[model samples]
Target: MLRRNFIAARDLEAELEQWQERIDIIRHKLKFIRQLPGVACIEQLNPPGTAGGRIPALVEIAGGTAIASEENGLLFPPDIVILMLPGKSIEESLREIGSLLEQPWFAESPALKNNRIYVTDCREYFQLPGPGMIDSLEILAEIINAGDFHFGFEGLGWIKFESGSPKNG
Candidate 1:
């Protein structure tokens, strides 16, 4: 029984190693040759703060700069803004974002001016940690480097926010 268990553990380790190699290849392919875009991930809106947990690290891995201050507020104008409210669907998140439209910060943000705001399905992609986090990273990659990577996640895993659009709210 001991030998059997050992063999099983070794096999699992080898499989995980292979899986990591494949993930590395994908990461390598997604590398941006130019400057990384400044990204702000908002996990909450009320008294707004930057996303907590693994999101910031994941943003960096996806080839974007996660810009936030120690107080959890935005330090500078971000090129892209992502809303990933925990347990909220894309539609629900959109409704919440509409409220931000009235805020001076939201109204004048570079992301708003450039129409670079996005809403993500946090429950499905970003809420939990594990393999799903890989999908989350891919989602970020698609949003940040829209020109190069195209995993076809748009409209499914995420939606670009267009202010004043009836569908947004």
Candidate 2:
């Protein structure tokens, strides 16, 4: 109120009120998203696929702090991606995931037979190894996404994706 052209107190108060309302709405939306079935800790997307475009990085999902330790600034590139296992039923969940993912592959290898091997269709087959071999999962391949994943395994410790190269030596 010092200067006539500065601004009116009423107008300033009304603007502040509108901003507060918008902030409240955004906060509610974020809370709702957090309560979703498979909410993840993703910051951004590389946008390679169509359906499942909003995927999180392995380091982000696994709670890894160092992102630069990986090959590049990211654990997986646009072609190579990571997912959050926020739910169970790997196969059913995979089908639920959209096409932002390419060359769908499990985190486990094909050595161990009893892990996840099934063939609903005669043309396609799948076989996954145990969790101990999960460290050898594909680097370029995308990670399956889930916010509330529940896998029946011997051990399931979250590992940082900043340890090694994309391929094993």
Candidate with the greatest TM-score versus the true structure: 1
Which pairs of residues have clashing backbones in candidate 1? none
- Candidate 2 local lDDT, 1-169, one digit each (tens): 5756666899878876765554344334334333211112222223322112212232223222212212112333232223333332334334533431222221322211112111111011111233222221221111222222223221232222321224431
- RMSD value for candidate 1: 4.7
TM for candidate 1 is 0.80
After TM-score superposition, what is the CA distance of residue 65 in candidate 2 from its true location, in Å?
13
With candidate 2 superimposed using the best TM-score fit, by how many Å does residue 144's alpha carbon deviate from the native? Answer: 19
Each candidate's TM vs. the true structure? 0.80, 0.22
Cα error of candidate 1 at position 137, Å: 0.7
Model 2 RMSD in Å is 17.9
Stretches of candidate 1 above 4 Å error? 1-11, 18-22, 30-32, 69-73, 164-169
Alpha carbon lDDT of each predicted model: 0.77, 0.27
For candidate 1, write residues 41-153 as lDDT tens digits: 88866666778678888898788889773443468878888988889989888878865565446666778877888999987889776667777877898898776667678
